[model samples]
Target: MDTHTPASHEVKLSLQTDLTPAQAEILDNGAQQFLEKLVQRFASRVPQLLAARETRQAAIDAGTLPDFLPETAEIRNSEWKIQNIPTDLQDRRVEITGPVDRKMVINALNADVKVFMADFEDSFAPAWNEVLDGQRNLRDAVNGTIDYTNPENGKHYQLNDDPAVLICRVRGLHLPEKHLLWQGEAIPGCLFDFALYFYHNYQQLLAKGSGPYFYLPKLQAHQEAAWWSEVFSFTEDEFGLPRGTIKATVLIETLPAVFEMDEILYSLKEHIVGLNCGRWDYIFSYIKTLRNHPDRILPDRQVVTMEKPFLNAYSRLLVKTCHRRGAFAMGGMAAFIPSKDPERNEWVLNKIQTDKLLEANNGHDGTWVAHPGLASTAMAVFDGVLGERSNQLDISRSEDAPITAAELLAPCDGERTEDGMRHNIRVAVQYIEAWISGNGCVPIYGLMEDAATAEISRASIWQWIKHGKTLSNGQMVTKALFEQMLKEEMDVVKQEVGEARFAAGRYDEAAVLMSRLTTSDELVNFLTVPGYEYLS
Candidate 1:
């Protein structure tokens, strides 16, 4: 369904759909020479990385417990810290994350936050148009020309003269950009996003006294960090930029990454900036990592808050580790999108304020907000704690008590309930429909749910059914039970969204896709893989 043709240069672009000249220009800007070089250098290495992932997954499937790498013990025990973080990346008190939709990009940059992580991963549904257009928007943003006009209200949006620091989050290592191929294989979406952005914007940003900053996603091993370091070095050499110009914040989203935190930091120390509390994916990863252990099954989604033993250990350990090693410790998203109801908005903002207060008190340098409206409320919390200080890396919270493996793997106590099961099914269906329709982040039940939360929702259902988890109502969760629950939830969704929009978004197909994911005999590593197949 994609067509290839030369565009503004010798390099051929695989065009999946027709593009306007301006859109084509964004793609063609430095795309020719840059993409060719990247494809030639990194194409062969994609398989090796993916194969390594499978090997680790196979071990998990076989009930092998992942531990700190023995070979990297020396690195972990060392007193070394990551290289100095840049000024712009130092005090990320509030970073708003979203897909690179034009309006979202404009609003996030002008949201008066410390940083804006323009996301190409969980927050985005990577259809071909979305990917290309996202790149264009980022370029335009860097150029200070990105803007949007609301067709409904005739309102215009643009960046502030002084905007938030921009940090781009590329696709995770596991995703493949099926639309683009090199050496007879689809290139890794991570590579495509990183290479294109660095190729086009590294020098441009450098001219403005900033550089290409990034948030690395879903890395399960330190080798992936090392691989990224090599890529950064390669980019610097190829582009004639200074070494260490590219700084990255790694999302400790996977369970294995939690155990290997020190090693991951050491591996990419020169290029590392911070460690983010990628709470949602970490929850999904916890379930997947311990899939073979029926005893490790989690409770209802609502009960698995960060205050739980396992989550608490993870957060405390991250802050301690990053601070001990002289790096910023970022907190997770407060996924509340302000509602239209004043009472609801006030309640949600108050909840976010308390959540952020915990992070700030725990010594997190910054936190994330889903909506622009919550930025002020979230920032007030961090600003109170971090008064006149860029970060609390000077505070050594680990000195009193260090985190142990047992604590990180501590089991939670709660009962699975019928309400929880139905909630997961409902969200899985609604979020998937939105994602399939090219909107990855959708607020349901007052929480901004993205692919990460959807993964948790669907994967929990699969795990519950696989382990025959019993609800509080004395009903055992089975495939048939889930199917029944799913149908009931579909009716709820239809009633909520009404007939026309639900049909337009193709919720029927999304329901079938979600059902397949939730009831499949084998677990799929990432739902986006299958979900993307239905796009375009």
Candidate 2:
């Protein structure tokens, strides 16, 4: 990919390759200049903060377990609250999330949920065309003009009269948009997504009585939240909008971030509306952050549900902190999709009901569902709790004693078996294959699986191998054992996917990547970082 500069701009914005006419319209001269400004002003801080992450991780590796910050104790103890929530964002009972494809945008907007998070992060593959096309599709949706017709079946899709409130989830700080470069460096993917979306559709959103809303993913610390706050303030100033026009919900998905929730909220209090339980990634973060600790190894991913002590502590603490700060405490995703068989579908609905009930009872103002079918189930749970109230923010958990770090880091109880190990290998390989093939969200074995869940699959295996943990069958987890299981799982995947589909997919490449990740001396920070090279 050679870089070519546009003639109309003085800024050094360059493209990896020439854009099509439609793509050019999305990244026109004004948008390019806005991106260049963002890159020049804020891009340097991304690497610095990422290095801070490593430094903190090194401390943890050297025997310093995370605790609430002493320096920021005043922030936690003092009384404060974020800016008020937007009118449209007040009652987010059930939010449906999906990739930003045209059909998904329309259907999600038309779903029974109160909000639809058009995701360019976990649920998207970030292929160049997908990245640009997502912005175009979202722009059309904001204008209430987006529509789609299935090319295969000719079934039509369009937004409903009262569609769900739209929110965009951009790529995390760690990801880079390799398709575009500022000076010689690739642009930060989050900045590109945010700047383009805000530039293109902020006016329409405001005109329609909404603003530029977003979901900030994978935040690790208050300092990172401070950086995003600066970006939000800068964008608002650039557009001559009000200070808090752009509201965000930060995903407290990392172990370190859990220890610093108060500080995180304080840092972005002007722009943040709430913090979400990105449970899948939180589990992945637990294994990754505590990888060097022998006693902290986790069991099968399926067994580590939210009811586990550590996760329960995390959820309870999130609700307490958010409500205390006058922000909504959104729940985690209910990733089940309805099955075709009646019995199985009934089981799926029951599971979703149980999960959503837990969140609603725990004081979460809202929850997430991956499929439209699960929306009604989640809504019923929240509806029962909320009654006519917009949210459960008024239901505080201050009566309970504070959640301690020990409880938050307690060892999860579960048994690891050969079946679980095989399942991990199979799901990781298949998800990676699908991700490389331009699908980041896929249903495997009934549940909707995304990058965060797949991260847990591989990270748990790596941690197990690192600690030489034993499975329930009395077999020690080793590099050799994982390799053997991977081989068996690949064969199983082949048979399940069939010869034609298996031959056509990138299973071999995915297997190689998975093997490298699980066996490497150092845990990779993110699978997508390396896998991004294979997106094209």
Scored by TM-score, the top model is 2
Pairs clashing within candidate 1: none
Instruction: Please write out the lDDT profile of model 2 over residues 346-370, one tens digit for every residue.
Output: 9999999999999999999999999
Clashing pairs in 2: none
**For model 2, the run of ten residues with the poorest summed lDDT:** 1-10
| Tens-digit per-residue lDDT, 383-462, candidate 1 | 89988987888877856576777788877788798999898888888888888888898889988899989999899889
Candidate 1 to truth, TM: 0.96
Candidate 2 — which residues are off by over 4 angstroms?
A: 1-9
Note the Cα lDDT for every prediction shown.
0.85, 0.93
